[model samples]
Target: MKIYPIETGNFKLDGGAMFGVVPKSIWQKTNPADANNLIEMSMRSLLIEDGNRLTLIDTGLGNKQSDKFFGYYHLFGDKTLDSSLAKLGFCKDDITDVFLTHLHFDHCGGSIEFNKDKTAYQPAFKNAKFWSNKEHWLWATEPNAREKASFLKENIIPIKESGQLEFINLSEDNYIKNSELNFDILCVDGHTEKQMIPHLNYKGKTLVFMADLLPTIGHIPLPYVMSYDTRPLLTLNEKQSFLNLAADKNYFLFLEHDAHNEICTVKHTEKGVRLDKTYTFNEIFN
Candidate 1:
């Protein structure tokens, strides 16, 4: 099995929101903010190539929003889904499965696109089945007031409309596994309802796709949870549990929103699970 990093683009988000109750003086050191106090973030996705199934984990922020709507996020960079796919000699139609970590705009927005007439929305991956867990599907569709803005209908409804939406039946341990795919699902509820993090067993290493659970290296500390998380206390416990397991298992964390660092590992330090080493995708995978 081969995994490719698909970089959709970069955008800026309020540093405070990304770092939760953590002080700017601390987080800014790792994810330095611009003059506007917004930190650069990458809408990074992963493409898993195994046999005939090309599963894509998390679609980045698509380009269907209005200029004013996008202006708020400060979208920048030349990398896009199409361009990145082209670089890999693939296209939207090549994707067989779109495994969404959750239905947040940035994580699933690219799953749909506007039709040629701009009058209808359609699934971006025409030949792909959109995968989302039942709990997250409901949480996003019937969003609470605090998370309503992030769960955009345009990013989600079309997948079901396309007759391609499927939910994973997680086991009692909140795990899902398919024989064809060389990975298992680790579902957690802190970030959102049942956000599924992929634990890929590739080349003798367990590479975890860190969706919003651990956005960047800056969030390695247990206290550094995101303010956008619906249950911050739950997130604290979730992160602690996941970090301890990751450190013990020596998992390679593939970061989603970290623009500077692509991947990192953790060590059981005196303080707790601390950042071990950072590397590009190719640095280790190649």
Candidate 2:
């Protein structure tokens, strides 16, 4: 099996929102912020190739939003879903599954695009089935006012309209559906409902999609949680438990937002699970 890092470009988010209760004085040193106090974050996605399955995890923010909306996030960079896939000698049409960690704009916005007629929305991966847990699907579709702004209808409704939306719930016996890949799902909340992070058994090593749960090595500290979390205390507990297991088991956590660092491991320091080392995805997989 082969996995490619799909970079959908970078966008700016308030450092405070990203770092949560962590003091700006500290987080700023690790993830330096701009004059606007916004940190540059990667809309990094992953493409998994196992047997005949080509699954793309979490489409990044697509270019369908209005310029005014784009003004807020300040999306910048030459990297995109198409270009990144091309770098791996593939294209969107080749994708057979889109495994969304959640439907947040930055994570799954690129799942759909505007039609040429400028009046309709269409699934970005025409041939791929869009994956989201049933509970999270309801949470996003019938979202609360607090999350409504982030859950745009255009990025979502089209997936259902395409007749490719599939829901994976706790009742599922096999997470991957196919026996081709030996990977499992680790579903968690606080960040969002039932966001599924992929855990893969690759070359005697376990690689996990850290999907906002750990986000970056900088977020290893439990209190370094993001303010965007629906439940900050719940996040603290989740991070504490996950990081401890990761440190003990020597698991590699893949960052979905860090602009520079891709994968990192944790170590049990006096202060608990702190950053141990950072490595590129290719370095680990190859």
Candidate 3:
């Protein structure tokens, strides 16, 4: 199996919100804010090529939103979903599966796009089966007041409307073994209900796609949970447990939102699991 790091685009988000309760004084050290107090963030996705299936995990914010809507996020960079796929000598239709960690705008917005005449919305990956868990699908579709803004209907409904949506019935085990994808889904909550983090076995290494569960190296410390999480205390417990397991088993964390650092490993330290090393995808695989 081969994995490709797909750079969809970059955008800005309020550093304070991203870092949650962590003081700006500390987070700014790693992610310095602009004059607007927004820090640049990457909407990074992953492409897995295994035998006949090509799976894409998360589709960064697409270009269908109005300028006014996008202005709020301050989108930047030339990299886009199509461009990234072109670089890998593939196209959207080639994707057999789109495994969404959650249905937040940044993660699933690119799942649908405007038609040529802008008359109606359609599935961006026409031939792909969009994979999301039943719990998260319902949570996003019937969003609560707290997360309504993040779950845009336009980005979501088209997949189901296109007859390409599929739900994974989560098993009792933490690790969901899927024969179709050849990966285990590490189910997580707190950020959102039933966020599925893919644990891929690649080249004798366990590569975990750390969705919002651990955004960046800055969040390695126990208290650095995000404010966006629905249950912060629950997130703390989940993070601690995952970090301990990661440290013990030496898993390579593939970050989805970290703009600068692509992959990192944590080591057991006196202060708890801390960043041990960072690497680009090429550094380790190439």
Candidate 4:
């Protein structure tokens, strides 16, 4: 199987919000903020080419939102989903499956797009089946007040409306071994309800899609949970367990939102798990 990193775009988010209660004095050292206190972030996605199935994990924020809507996030960058795919000699129609880690706009907004003449919303990946779990589907669709802003109807409803949405069967422990997508899925509830993290064994190494569970290298510490997380205490436990397992097994973490660092690995440090090293996608994947 061949995997490629898809750069959809870049945007800025409040560093305080990204790092939660972690003081700016600490997080700013790693994720330095701009004058506006916003930190630049990447809307990076992953594309896996296995046999005839080209599965894309997360689609990034699409360009359908209004300028006023996008101004809040301060979107920037020349790389787009189409351009990235084109560089790989592919296009939207080439994708067979779209595995969404969650329904947040930055992660799954590119799933749908405005149709021709902008009359209607439609699935962006015309030939691909959108993948999400039943639990998350409900959580996003019927979002709570805190997360309502992040789960936009324009970015979500179209997938189900298009009749191309599919749910992955999750086990009781929230672990799926050898899923139909050709990887293991670890579903955690801390970062939203049932956010699925994909674990892929590729090139003799285990590569995990960090998603929001570990947004950036700055978030390696167990206490550095995002404020957006509904259950911060649950996130603490989940990160503790996952980080320990990751350090022990030496997993290569594929970061989706880290604009500067593409992949990272953690090791057991005296201060608990810490960033061992960082790699650009090419440094290891190539």
Candidate 5:
């Protein structure tokens, strides 16, 4: 099995919001804020190639949003989906499955693109069967007042409209069965309902895709939950439980949004599960 780290580009997000309840003084140490209080973040995605499957997890923020809309995030970087795939000798059409951890604009926006005529949005990976949980699909489609802004209709709907949408397990035991991906779904509700985190067995190691649940290494502490999460308390419990299990089992956490660290290990420190070590994908995967 082979895994590729796709650089979908980088953008800025308010550091305070990204680390809910955590003071800027603390988070700024790791993610220094710019003059606008925004910190640079990577919309990093993963590509898995094994047997008959090539799955891409999480598309970065797409390019269809208007300049005015993008002005807020200050999107910058030359590494796009096309360019990144080219580096790997593949294209969007080569993807057979698109496993979305959630439907947030940063995670799923790149899944679809605007047509040249600007009349309609279309699936970015036409050949890929988009994977999302039924609960998350509904939560994103019918977004609540708190998270409606994060769930853009343009980034979504097109996959379903294109007749390529598929649901993962609802009971928590259902894992997507593909030759390339033999992983369990770590479904959590704190950050939107039923957000799917893929736990994979790769190269004799256990790796987990830490979506928004643990956006950065700084969020290893249990209380460092995101303000965007619907249920912060639930998130705390889930994070603690997961961290304990991860520390015990020695799982390499593959971060999705962290700008610097791609993977990390945690320890059961007195302060909580603190960052033990951090490394790039190749450092661990290779």
Candidate 6:
């Protein structure tokens, strides 16, 4: 199996929102904020080429939203989903599966796009089966007031409408081993309901896709939970358990939202789990 990093785009978000109640004095050290107090973030996705199946995890924010709609996020960057795939000698039609970690705008917005005439929305990857779990599908479709803004109908409804949506059944333990996508899925509910984190065995090492569960290296500490999380207490426990296991097993964390650090590993420090090191995607995979 071959893996590649797909950088879709970059944007800025309020650092306070990203780090939750964590003081700026602390988080700013790792994720420095701009003059406007927004921190830079990357919409990085992962592409896995195994046999004939090319699975893409998280589609990033697509370019279909109106300028006024995108003005809030402050999107910037030359990279895009199509351009990134082109660089890898591939295109939308080449993707067989789109595994969404969650249905947040930044994570799955690129899954759907405007049709040729811009008359209606359609699945962005014409040949790909959009992967989402029943629980998350329901949660996103019927979003609560707090998360309603993040779950845009334009980005999600088209997949189901296009008849390409598929649900991955969750096990009793919320873990799926050797899923049809050819990897283990670790399901957690703290970030959003049933966010699936993918675990892949690459080069004799376990690589985990750190979705919102651990957005950046700045969130390695036990208390650095995002304010957007509906259940912050649940997030604390989930992070503690996951980070401890990640440290003990030496998993290479593939960060999805960290703009500066592409990957990271944690270690058991006296102050609990802390960032051990960081690596660019090419540094380890190239």
Better model by TM-score: candidate 1 vs candidate 5: 1
Q: lDDT rank, highest first?
A: 4, 6, 1, 3, 5, 2
Q: Looking at candidate 5, what is the lDDT of residue 183?
A: 67
After TM-score superposition, the amount by which residue 171's alpha carbon in candidate 3 deviates from its true location, in angstroms, is 1.2
Tens digits of per-residue lDDT for model 4, 152-234 = 99988989989999999999998999997989999999989999999999888999999999999999988899999999999
User: Could you give candidate 2's per-residue lDDT for residues 133-165 as a string of tens digits?
Assistant: 788999999998888988999998889988999
Candidate 3 local lDDT, residue 219: 87
lDDT of 4 at 243: 95
On lDDT, who's better, 1 or 3? Answer: 1
For each candidate, the alpha-carbon lDDT, in order, equals 0.92, 0.86, 0.91, 0.94, 0.87, 0.94
TM per prediction: 0.98, 0.95, 0.98, 0.99, 0.95, 0.99
User: What is the alpha-carbon lDDT for the whole of candidate 2?
Assistant: 0.86
Look at candidate 1 and tell me the lDDT of residue 91.
94
Model 5 has a clash total of 0
lDDT of 1: 0.92
Question: In candidate 2, residue 149 scores what lDDT?
Answer: 88
Clash count (model 3, backbone only): 0
- What is the per-residue lDDT of model 3 for residues 1-286, given as tens digits with 9 covering 90 to 100? 8999999999999999988888999999888899888998898999999889999999999989999999999988899999999988999999999999999999999999999999999999888999998889999999999999999999998888899999877887656896346788988888998999999888889999998999878888888988899998989999999999999999999988888999999999888889999999999888
lDDT of 5: 0.87
Best candidate, lDDT: 4
- Tens-digit lDDT string for candidate 6 (161-250): 999999998999988999979899999999899999999999788989999999999998988999999999999999999999999999
Write down the TM-score for model 6: 0.99
The sequence of per-residue lDDT tens digits that candidate 1 reaches over residues 33-103 is: 99988999999999999889999999899989999999999988899999999999999999999999999
Q: Is candidate 4 or candidate 5 better by lDDT?
A: 4
